[model samples]
Target chain A: MRWKHSDYTGWGRVHRASGELARPERAAALSELTKDETAPAIGMRRSYGDACLNDNGRAIDMSRLDRVLEFDPDSGVIHVEAGAQIGHLLKTFAPKSWLPPVLPGTGFATVGGCIAMDVHGKNHHGAGSFGQHVTEITLVTPKGEQIVTPKKHPELFKATIGGLGQTGPILSARFPLLKAKGDVMVVTERRVADWESFIGLLDTSEATYSVGWIDATARGAALGRGILEEAETGGGLVKPAKRGKKIPLNAPGFALAPPVVRAFNATYWRRVPDRGRTSVKPIDDFFFPLDKIHDWNKLYGKNGFHQFQCVVPLSSVDALRAILEKIANSGLASPLAVLKRMGPGRGGYMSFPMEGYTLAVDFPNKARAEQVIRELENMTVAADGRVYLAKDALASAANIRAMYPEHDKWLSAVTKADPDRAYETDLTRRLKLRDPA
Target chain B: MTPTWIILGATSTIARAFARLVAERGENLLLAGRDMAELNRTAADCINHGAPSAEAIAFDARDMASFAPILDKATATEGAINVAVFVGSMPTQDEIDGDPALIAGTITDSFTGPAQFLTLLAPLMEDRGKGAVVGVGSVAGDRGRLGNYVYGASKAGFHTYLSGLRNRLGRSGVHVVTVKPGTVDTAMTWGMDGLPFLAQPDKIASDIMRAVDKKKNVIYTPFIWWPVMTVIKSIPEAIFKKLKI
Candidate 1:
């Protein structure tokens, strides 16, 4: 395997890593590479923070190893390389009435990434986290490869899922696909007047998939105002999604200035009528709306951006509202803010899901924006909520440890799996997750 | 009737991309490669993509004995039988210079092996009288450069062989496409830097499919390589020998 020196960053682009990357095209090559020296495995690098970054270290790029190894139509079980993209799987299987049980905000997030983060989707209220549906995982450590299942190696399986890839490189996985009506989605979009109604709508939602687009710049009476989208799979004929357009150059810093973001959010909120409207859309359009604008992160300009995401318990709705109000008052939030309801279902000790409301907001990498995110992180910890490691870039190590009560359990399992810390990444090191301090 | 595509070196990036394209068009696929595990995964991927049927067959470009079973499997199926050759090996010029004996293996892998296999399959394809054979060569074959002359010479030989095969196969209504691709983003060129006009495997696969549909005898992928190679070929040999590319 040839190791290429490369400089890469996460999806947010705020944190960067200059490292040596080895991309093996076959499973045998991947096994051979990991047989002696193990490195952190990265797929598509879709995480918003440093989860996929390994500064001055070696990382194995698993993108080339993506391929469906086997599929049983009768049981809907699929054995696939860890690098397979969630969107590609949905596109290939939706036509046959099958879909991945959980899809993150972007289709580009690989199955391995989803498992590593235990990501949830709009259907989290029903389908649970991504790792919940995994039947088995093949993990490659420095020693060799081992097949891990929930029943055979329950603790190892839990540690591998949402374990921040500290255990080892996930080689492949077996998971059952969800049955879908068709490739298209019937979506209903409605406007929420304020924070109260938005939370009410989310709580009362009965749809299989539901999510809210929050207007973070709104204040006073319009605080937390946004659009609520509920969708279900339906058989229909629709035009194929257009090829994504690329953002050729970085925008000027003024592109996402507060005034501009407020204006854009106002217009976006107004796009949905007050009474709401229903439409038919390609599944991708509804799930990954931002993906249509390729490299949309460039809009944040050269310095890059950060996404602050956290989930709070149902009883902490007041704390969540206080956090939203703080964000609106700061006027530093980008237009890319989201609100969703999550279930208690989770597959790992480190998995970041609970029965609550989750909020995510993007901010350009500025001193003021970072300050606001820090404040938000403190508020989340005080509310007994956990900030998503996948999107966090500035949370304190102590705060992170305090949020996940079972951190010690995960650390012990990870230590047993990778005693030498061969799979340690920038995030794990920065957070001191394995230090046991 | 749906055609059955016999893809040699199916584990290769370009061949896998081509298999996916044809599979999506509802063709049957016989993925031939040395690594049965990798080839089986690719076959399953093709089936998932929409192929009516897909199977992996063991094949080694350097082993003549491994070629017959693939042809037999292809002939067993009715209707048109297509074959796409994407088998070739290139060790760095420095490695080849260290061990001159490497030249023989390179020649067999890139040129003579596929040539002999095609020579054996030609009669069967002519009898069927309906098929296309895609032989992927390289732009390096146009002119020997300071960097990789041995690999270039092998591809040059393959280009000449395909040209003659095209002449013989066209008479029986079987089209032959000689593909000369420039640098591609595959495992072979993963770490190499400063590669000009680097094309993706999907784009090359699509170009190959278009050439087959149009029955083009010789073509350069990404189109720009044709002009680029033309200028390089026009350069006098003395100047070329002194300069490094």
Candidate 2:
């Protein structure tokens, strides 16, 4: 067994075992790693934090192994290597004007990694999570690495989905894809004043395929409440542009000030009419616009950035209000804050989806900013919600433990899967995603 | 006469690109990470990009005691650690699952180990009269999150250490830059979700280098994160302990 860890952060930032790192494209890379007494599936480096690192044990970077093994246009089902990134797959289907029912903000993430996190998206209010769309997962378990699907091993299946790679290495996944209405999305952005209005807006809309918000300036009344957006692609009304037409590469890390982002938000809002019509085109504009840029993440500049996302119930809308007020009153205007209404959810131990509204905020590394985040986490917990671990860069173990009460069960399950604790990554070690299963 | 940079965590997707970016502008470099073989591979890659002499060093961020030896060997040729950057750490994503001590160890390795290493190297730079040490700190240190407080605390301590060092060493000719990269696409937040403006490591590394050169004390990768964080911090605990984000 061999290990190699590489991320999109850059080639030099990646880690690899000189002795290992087989071209997974030739064969299943994760299979080689799982062969080790302890190994976990490796996906593309789109994860926001350290949940994928297997450390010295073994890591199977799935990037090279990425391939669409099979796709059923009729049933909207596809099976791909655990390493296949969403973007690669999108290219294959979006041209035919089809897309994954649910997707994370980052398109570079792998399907297997998405399921492991049970990723939720802007359309979560209408769609459940990534796990909901997943019909089966081909996993490499300690029990001789069998192909376990929801029907085959329901317990392991549920555990594996949103299991944080603790249950086993997912070799491949089967999911139901959706036909894109068109390649473009008809999105409308409406500004909100407070959490109540944001929640109220969600109650009214959000069934429109996609939903999001930007907590810009995080200012007074509009603190947590910023820009509320709802979008849906046209029903095949517009055609997608050429797939091969490459978008220009990303520019350097210039600062995104409140004025700039706020202007962007304002312009975006202006461009978007006030909920007068229903229309759409090009999934790129709607689903993963920034993805078109090679190094889009650079907008944050070099100091880098951290993204914190969490889900809280509609019942806790008041708590949401508190978050917004605090941010605004803090005088630390956020450039972006998003709000979304969610639908029925599938419960996974480490998954971030639940019945309610999810809010995602991006803050630069400011000493005072962290204080606001701590306060936000406490409020989210009090509201009976948990922080999204995948997007989190700085969550505390105690908070994670408390938020995910089933954490112990997940740990025990991981322990049982590999008693020697052979499979351990930086993420597992950090979040204690190490299930003592 | 371009300055050559060698990063131990080179080949870390971000680090590799960063090395190349710097080297491309005529800076010579030696990129190194876990894979010594891959380290050389990245070095050769930089050479292709315009780095006159990009190379690799086999060093580990986890081992505290061994850093000095590695630095000793490294400085033997380089003379001093000019722009030393570290992005390697056992990033904790899961909650404390099994042993408390084990979790502590992760924090110790991620935080204390780096802190101690910096402590060891600080004087060296001060004596030499010019150097920079940049670290990636997390917003998790602000207070504590319901999801990852321990890791956050460790970063907090690390940030503090950098702060203290920055204050003390500024006059001594050694510049300590603490970079608070928000959410980045590294191996750190695997399986986590709903990232807004999540950063990429290469950009982060580049940003850190720019900040180091510009002599910025603390940098929030994305500047907006700064004001955003300020608002989050100003939240009074009375209400802070209760609201959900």
Candidate 3:
């Protein structure tokens, strides 16, 4: 395999990596490359932070290795190469009434990336994180190909899931697809008046899939005001999703200025009526709304952006509100913000979900925004919450360690799996995750 | 009756993509390749994608002995038995220069092997009176460049052979499409630098299917290669040899 020198970035585009990348298209080629020299495996680079970046080193690009190796219709189990995209899986199986149990905000994320990040979805409160659904994982370690499952090698399995690809390059995975009513989603959108009501609505929601779109720019009586979307899969026919449009160039910086954002948010909030509205949408439309606009990250312009995401306990709702208040006062928050409830279902030690409320807001890559995110990270730690590593680009290692109490266990497991640290990436180094210190 | 596409070198990136395309249309597939494991996986994938029936058969391009069984299996299904040949090899010119013995294998893989298999299958296509044959040749066949003249010469010979095959097959109502694709972003060109206007394997596959539907005999994929190759082919041999691309 020839290694091509490439300059790549995370979804945020705030962090960049110049590295040599080898994209192997077959399973034998992947094993052969890993046997000779191990490197971090990256798929799609959908992480908003540097979790996928390996600067000044060789990395394996697994995109072309994507394929469905096997599928058992009776059991709904699928064996796929790690590079298979979650969206592609849904497209293939959804029509047949089988769907991936957990889908992140974007369908572009590969199965390997979902496993590495332990991503959650709109149905996270019910289906849990992506790793929780996986039955088996084939990893290429220093010794050779090792198969790890929840039953066979539980510790290594937990460490590999949401393990940030530190344990080894994942070769393939086996997971069961959830039976769906159909390929379409019946969605209900209701406007939340304020913070208290929004929290109450989320707490009482019985929908299979629920998420809140918060207008971070709102203040006072309108604080936390947004649209609450609840959805459930149903048997129906809908038009095929339109062809995705690409963002050809970086948008001007002024395009998302505070005044412009406030105006946009106001328009968006008013788009949903007070009485609420019900619509039938393509599964991808409801699951990955912004994906229709390809490279939507470029909307933040050349400087890129950072997404500050953290989940606080059920009791820490007040603390979460205070953090939101601080963000609103700072006037640096973008219109793109989400609030969701998570269940106490997580597969890995480093997994990000808990039984609590999670808030995620995007901020332009400004010095002031960095300072605000640092303050938010501290507040999250104080509230016994943890920042999501997938979306975090500015959190300090000390703060991250404080958030994930199982850090030592994860570190020990990773060390045992990769003693030579050949799989380290920019995120691992930045967080000092491999260091006992 | 549903058509059955016998894809030679089915493990190849382009052939795999073409298999999926035809499979989605509910066609039957005979994925013929040397790698049984990989070909079986692709066969299963094609089935999942919507093929009525898909099977993997062993095929070694250089071994003419492995060719007849694939034809016999396709003939068992009473319908239009189409074929798409994606078998070829290109050892870098530097490697070829170091080991001159590689030329024979290159010629067998890129030209003589598939040509012989198709020669054996042509009469069967004539008996059926309806089928499509897609021959994947590279633009390198248009003019031998300094970088890979030997590999180019093999494809050039295959292209000429295909032209004659088309003439004979046209009389029996069978269509032939000679596809000249530019650099495609497959395993073959994955990390190759300075590849111009590289197309995706899926795009080339779709283009080939469209050409079959339209019965276009010779076409350049991505269309841009047509004008580009035109310029190169028109250049006098003296200047072309002197100017390195």
Candidate 2 local lDDT, A247-296, one digit each (tens): 24332333566567666656654454554345454666566655665554
Error of 1 at B71 (Å): 1.7
> Which candidate gets the maximum DockQ versus the true structure?
1
lDDT of 1: 0.93
Question: If scored against the real structure, what TM-score would every candidate get?
Answer: 0.98, 0.58, 0.97
Ranking by DockQ: 1, 3, 2
- The TM-score-based order of candidates, best leading, equals 1, 3, 2
Give the lowest summed-lDDT range of ten residues in model 1 chain A: A138-147
lDDT for each candidate structure: 0.93, 0.65, 0.93
For all the predictions, what are the DockQ values? Answer: 0.79, 0.01, 0.65
Candidate 3 error regions (>4 Å): none
* Interface RMSD per candidate (angstroms): 1.0, 12.4, 1.4
Model 3 native-contact share: 0.52
Which is superior by DockQ, 1 or 2? 1
